[model samples]
Target chain A: MKELLNLFLTFARIGALTFGGGYAMLPILQRELVDQRKWVTEEELMDYFAIGQTTPGVIAVNTATFIGQKRKGTLGGAIATLGVVFPSIVIISIVAMFINNFADSVILQNAFAGIRVSVYVLILNAVLKLWKSAIVDKIGIIIFIAIFSLSIFTNLSPILFIVGAGLAGFIAKRQQGVVS
Target chain B: MIYLRLFYEFLQTGLFAVGGGLATLPFLYDISDRTGWFSYGQLADMIAISESTPGAIGVNMATYSGNMVAGIPGGIIATLGLITPSIVIIVIVAHFLNKFKTNEGVQGVFYGLRPASTALIAAAGFSVVLIDLVDFDLFRQTGSFIQLMNWRALFLAIVLYILANHIRATKQLHPVIFIAFAALVGIIFNFGLN
Candidate 1:
């Protein structure tokens, strides 16, 4: 029960603090989950991130689910996911009630203009950090370039790219194992 | 009935909006087109609010849109629909796939997935830059390169990027500080001023 509460509180803090989205949550997740709690290693966190991206639903929720399930069980997963989304539920519900008044404010508009620019930078930083760990081999580089191009230029679903790359890697690994 | 529809729609979104939170944008746009529960303009507002506020953008968006449709209960139901798939899948994986953690095939899949995820994120970052800094539609209509870019936004982005990356003090500061600073500058400069 204590562990469940801890999971809820920890992820609640994470959910509350994250501003930009899933990618921007990386640093905070690292600080709280990896560094402080040692619940998961950096590599495991990265794996969760990768899995979260490929899976259906929001990456943050998916990740919270993964971590929580790893920690306790199904119930833990539900609590953590609930914790992470609780803030959004409360905040957005309030915003929805008074959206008209808030959306039209000039001060808020200008603030968002600036905030949007910073969000791009935050995402860029995340991409760079992930790139360092992700692109380690020739195959990795090829997959990166292929998916990057497809994502930028086409309307193709990212799910297809992820699945295809996974299959390609599986095949390539199998071949290497056979030869060596 | 409205709540049930909300649940079903959001469940579909949760099942298919792969990649990340932003990937749900297309689905939301579709929902707007089909249901008219919210207008495109309202969807834009939801995106802005979702991006700026704490928590996942997807979750915020679902909550906002659902509330618009059927009040607070609708929001709760929609969010629950969205996360149900994740919880179910992760539980199955956690319980049954523990042994596969170090399996060769699984490792290979992860190896490939890591880079692919990175690429997708980089592409997402690129589009954010395009949307925030460049106005291609404006340029196409006006046929002026200078008119295409929001120079002030670009300048602020560059400056903030440098500060966040290079300066020791600013680098160490929480990202919320930068976001707040940008907001203050935007207000003072009257950015986005028509």
Candidate 2:
């Protein structure tokens, strides 16, 4: 029960603080979950992001659910998922009541402009860290380039890239008999 | 009732919007067309608000859109509706992955997936930086390469980047702290006024 509450509060903090949605949650999650709590490793979090992206529904919610379920079970998963969105429900409801004011607030606009740049830096650093770990080998680099290109140059969903890369890795590794 | 409709509508969206928060946009567009819940302009406005606020963009949109339709209860119902699918799907997927976690084939799959996921995020990072640092709207208007930079944001970004990555003391600071500092800087400089 205590663990569940911790999960809830931790995720609620994550949901509340991250401004730009799913991808932006990465750096924060790395800090809170990996660096602070030791709930998951950076690698496990990457795994969750991959799975979260491929699965249906919002990636941020899926990640919360994944981490929670890893810790406790269905109920833990439910609680964590709830925690992540709880802030959204409350904050959005409040903001909705005065939607016009928020929409027109120049102060909020200026703040967001800065927030956006900071978030970009955060995501860029996270991506750089991920690159060092994820793109280690020749084949890994090849897959990275292919998927990166596909992500940019095509209108296809990332789910396709994930599935294809998984299959390619499976077949490629099997042929090499490299059980890494 | 409207509550049931909100739940049902977002449930469908939660199920089918398979990638992430942004993926929900087309479905929201469809909702506007079918249910007349909000207009395209309103949807755009909702997105702007969603982007500018905290929380997942999808949840914010549902809350804002539902509130527009039916007030506070509407926000709750719509949000609950949106997240329902994530809980169900992730729990099932997590269960299987836990069981297969040690399997070699699964390990191999993740090996490739790690890089793929990194690439996906890097792509997102590129798009984000592009959006934040470039004034494409202004570029299109004047068709002048030299005038394309959002100079204030770019300067802020460079300063923040160096502090975040280069300065050892600052690098160890919490990201939220940096974000807070950035927000402060943004307000002082009126970041978007230019």
Q: Could you give candidate 2's per-residue lDDT for residues B1-194 as a string of tens digits? A: 99999999988878766557765765675577678988754664566567767898888888888888899899889888998999998888887876665676866776777788777767756754665577789999999987698887788889989999899989877566667777788889898587
Question: Interface RMSD (Å) of model 2?
Answer: 5.2
* Cα lDDT tens digits for candidate 1, A1-180: 999999999999999989867887899999999999999999999988877876667999999999998898889999999999998998888877876567788888887777777767766776777778767989999998998898778867665776787788888888888999
User: lDDT value for candidate 1?
Assistant: 0.81
| Consecutive 10-residue window with the lowest summed lDDT within model 2 chain B | B40-49
Kindly provide the TM-score of model 2 when superposed on the true structure, using C-alpha atoms: 0.65
| Most accurate candidate by DockQ | 1
Query: What does the lDDT read for residue B15 in candidate 1?
Result: 74
Candidate 1 at B158: error in angstroms?
0.8
- CAPRI class assigned to model 2: acceptable
| Candidate 1 C-alpha error for residue B3, in Å | 5.4
- Please list the Cα RMSD from the true structure of every candidate, rounded to 1 decimal place: 4.6, 6.5
Q: Which stretches of candidate 1 lie over 4 Å from their true place?
A: A1-73, B1-58, B61-71
